[model samples]
Target: MAHRKWIVWIRRAILLVLLGALVYHSTIVIQIIRFRTINPRMTALMRQRAREARARGQVPKRLQVWLPYERFSPHLVRAVLAGEDPRFFVHHGFDWDQIREAIQENLEEGEIVRGASTITQQLAKNLFLSTSRNPVRKLHEAVITVELEMLLGKRRILELYLNVIEWGDGIYGAEAAARHYFGRSAAQLTPEQAAFLAAIIPNPRETYNPARHPARVERRRRIIQRRMRHVLIPAPFRAASAKAAESAFAP
Candidate 1:
């Protein structure tokens, strides 16, 4: 009986492997047919969340509004890259150097001193997965990050990330965040406002308040300005951005 049970378990394992392979191949074929679409896993999750919200008789609070890359100001994009992911243009989906440094910092501090996610990895997590922190979910994020980067170039990746990332509880995208926070379109957002908006993305739901967190907003704005001066964006754009930033923060 023990021998028969062992053989049965082995057979089940083989069947599971075959099923996994079939699904994997099907996924590849589907992806080939939909190269420009959001990752399938993300679309499914979005639908599931919407369906669950409807089942609970709750309106889904998510607000996603995709815009073309051309709609956003190049300065705003540069500010986001400078603030969030400086190596976005050069790195692949993963930045192992930053990951290693983050791990070391966390170990040394006994707290999360740094984030290990690259822009692509963050985009995958924001679009497809929840805020749950676990090895299994992180592995899935990494896999999907690679797929997204393979299918979309850096420009498209940044554009989609800017458009879909949650800025406040019910606000999403650069356009929405700008309107919600500053009463302006993303194209008209002054550099200080744009920098403050970028600062909030790390913890959008908690960190910012247009009324209450003035000090924190000023500090983050300064950091963004300093970094903006050092890198990203062209020199003329930088000068104009600096001027706008100074004007925005002027009492």
Candidate 2:
């Protein structure tokens, strides 16, 4: 009788532990789904209001504003695409070639100078993580990246990235970045201005100061212009894009 009771207790304990784990996993899944599918417009509006409040030296109501893709210029999108991931449209959530190359580079340098994270991976990190660099955080980032890719399509993922990308210390999204960097709307960003913003994505905190880093900005702008000159868009749109970028880093 004693042996049977002990066995029963052990089984019950095992079952309880399994149930607890199931519940925890279910909660995390629910949160991920909600985060991925929540109305983006509402989030954008809230962020915009918060940005305004912060600019006015009032209490910030939110962390960041995320502008929808429509509010951004095609040049902005193209510049980001060219600079970050030229094969963005072709990959699912991970790019094997880039991953392999980054691995090789890391091994050769004995450092982590290159990361092969796709746009989806970047979104997963931006939306869900703090600035902790740990194995646990990296594992979670990968899991969440897969989950988000499963939940959101490529277009939706890109949309989220465009809106959520941190442009400056407090600036978020292309619209805010364009206004803060160039004194214009996102839709008005030209290829050069867009390229300047794109160049800063690698290290936004250190790379994107217009007044203080005029030389660096000019160099990046020239590079972006040179790279994008051959790319084609509509004539009128191209003219407007060129206009916005013409005096992008001008004092």
Residue pairs clashing in model 1 are none
Provide the lowest-lDDT 10-residue window in model 2: 232-241
Tell me the spans in candidate 1 whose CA falls farther than 4 Å from its real position.
1-11, 14-18, 21-58, 100-114, 207-214, 233-251
Runs off by more than 4 Å, candidate 2: 1-25, 35-65, 100-115, 207-251
Q: Estimate, for each residue in 28-56, the C-alpha lDDT of model 2 and write its tens digit.
A: 56865676567444333345546667899
Clash count (model 2, backbone only): 0
> Residue-wise lDDT of candidate 1 within 66-147, one digit each (tens)?
6666667555776787667767777888877777866886588553423578888887777667777898678768777878
- By TM-score, the best candidate is 1
User: What is the C-alpha local distance difference test score of candidate 1?
Assistant: 0.68
The lDDT per prediction is 0.68, 0.66
